[model samples]
Target: MKFALAQINTTTEVADNLEKVRTYTRDAAEAGARFVVFPEATMSAFGSGLRTIAEEHMESWRSALSELAVETGITVVVGEFATTADKVINLLAVYSPSGERSDYAKIHLYDAFGFKESDTVEAGEEPVLFTVDGEDIGLALCYDIRFPKLFAELSRRGARLTVVAASWGAGPRKAEQWEILARARALDSNMFIAALGQADPEVTGVAVPKKGPTGVGHSLVSDPLGKVLNSLDGAERLEIVELDLSAADTAAETVPVLTNAKLGY
Candidate 1:
């Protein structure tokens, strides 16, 4: 199956962000992509003052995404900030071509690198694993990529592809860290890894003027053997790559990492 990684700039306005998503989804679908994954916080700005969409707005967003999926005949994995009773939840919503929807909350909050994501966002308790076109896919958020155990658990659950939506901040060695973590996770789990990140010059708000680049947008895909199939750097673009599920099976047979490691769980 071919997957498209959409590296886009997001802002506080839901409508504006959805428009960008629509454009990319159409483009990706036209390019023969079976699935398209967007970066994290695509519905809102990724910062200390993140905004959550109201219940009504959330429903509207879901409806729009469902329509997009049905029209394009492709699956879409999109990120958004959902409002809860106590706080906002970082969520990834998966929309199938048949208009089915599933949501996955972020399990690992970004409380590192001088940012306290846990202060406002609630962590999810379960990992999300779903199937599309006979392929098992796992969903993870930004900080979740840094944890190998999560990827291993997904592999154990029969996930051939793991998708990570990230709003990775830019700093010293942060880009390198993203690439290393992505490759390591794919290699260790013997699965394909699709890591999509938000681009820089972040759209702060509806009213605020856009600034220069800030976020790191190195969206990439790695095979089971840790080989990067395709990657995008320093721009908002669509990257499409065909993934072979049989390669993952072959990698597992050769390395036998999952079977070799004995775990208490």
Candidate 2:
């Protein structure tokens, strides 16, 4: 199956972000992709007023996702936020053409690199996965990629491919760390890892709020064997790559990391 990885700069405006999603979904659908993955902060970028949009625009966000799925006949996974009384939940919203919709809240909040995501975002308790045509797809967010246990748990629960949505912070070796972490997680879980990141704002000349982990665009996909199939530089782009989903099974059969594990989640 073919998958499209969407890399674009997220903004503080939700409407503009949704329009970007629609445009990318159309492009992916026309290119014969069954699944299209958008990076984190698809609803709005990480800046001030995040909670406001999460509170007011959540219903419309869901509506757009559902409508996109039904219209394009493809499963859509995009990042969004849902408001809580005290904070917001960083969410990965999933929509299938069959009218099935589900979400995975971000389990691991970004509390590192001098950023305190937990101050505004609540962490998810459960690891989530959904199926498309009998092929299981796992869900994860930015900091979640750092925890190998989550990936193993998703694979334990039957996932051949994992989607990691991120709006990575820009700093020393951060981009390299993102790439290494993606490849390492692919190896750890023995599954295909699609690491989608937001486009670098600097590339687009968009002034982002300071101290925000806006983006450092280098979205990529790693096969079960941890080989990079395709990757993007720091730019806004929509790249598609086909995957032999069955390769996950072969990698598992050859390495057997999940089966031969001495640990458990």
Candidate 3:
């Protein structure tokens, strides 16, 4: 299957962001991409008290994305926020080509690097996995990338691919850490991993008072062997990579790491 990782500069304006999503979804569909994954908070500005915005525009956002998925005939996995009874949840919304929708809330919140995501966002309790083209694809958010156990559980549940939506803050060695963790997860799980990030400049004006820019958009796709098949630099762009579903099985056969792994209690 061919997957497109869309790296965009998301802004506070929901309409403008939705337009960008439409444009990019069209481009990806025209390029023969069956699935397109967008960066976290693609529907709204991150760190801008997202709960308020999510409560106001959740239905509109869902309607637009579902329409786009049905129109373009491509599956979309994009980031969004949702308001629960108690707090807001960071989410990855999946829109299938058939217009069916599913979502995964972020399990891990970003509480390091002087940021306190937990102050407003509530953590999710479970993982989400869906099938596309006979492949089980796992869903995760930005901070979840740092936890190996999450990916391991997805692999154990027969996920051939893991898609991560991120709004990773840029700082000392942050980009390097992103690459290292992405590759490590793929290698450890023997699954194709797609880590998509939001670009800078657009997220620069977010409510967070940071020392520097927030996002370092180096969205990448890694194969089962931990090899980066395609990647983008610090720019707003879209890159598609074709993945062989059987490759994960092949890697598992060659390495047998998944079979050999044991939890040390």
Q: Against the true structure, whose lDDT is highest?
A: 2
Query: How does residue 52 of candidate 1 score in lDDT?
Result: 39
Q: For model 3, how does the per-residue alpha-carbon lDDT over 59-172 read when each residue is reduced to its tens digit? A: 999999999999999999999888878788889999998989998989999898887888878999899998787778999999999998899889989998999889888878
Off by over 4 Å in 2: none
Q: In angstroms, give how far residue 222 of model 3 lies from its true place.
A: 1.3
Ranking by TM-score: 2, 3, 1
* Every candidate's CA RMSD: 2.8, 1.2, 2.4
Give model 3's TM-score versus the native structure: 0.93
Which residue pairs show collisions in model 3?
A: none
Cα lDDT of candidate 3 equals 0.85
lDDT comparison, 1 vs 2, better candidate = 2
Q: Residue-wise lDDT of candidate 2 within 83-181, one digit each (tens)?
A: 888999999989999878999999998989888999988899999998877888899999898999999999989998999999999999999999999
lDDT for position 166 in model 2:
91
**Which lDDT tens digits does candidate 1 get at residues 70-183?**
999999999977776777888998999998999899999887877788877889989998777888899999999998889998999999899999878778899999999999
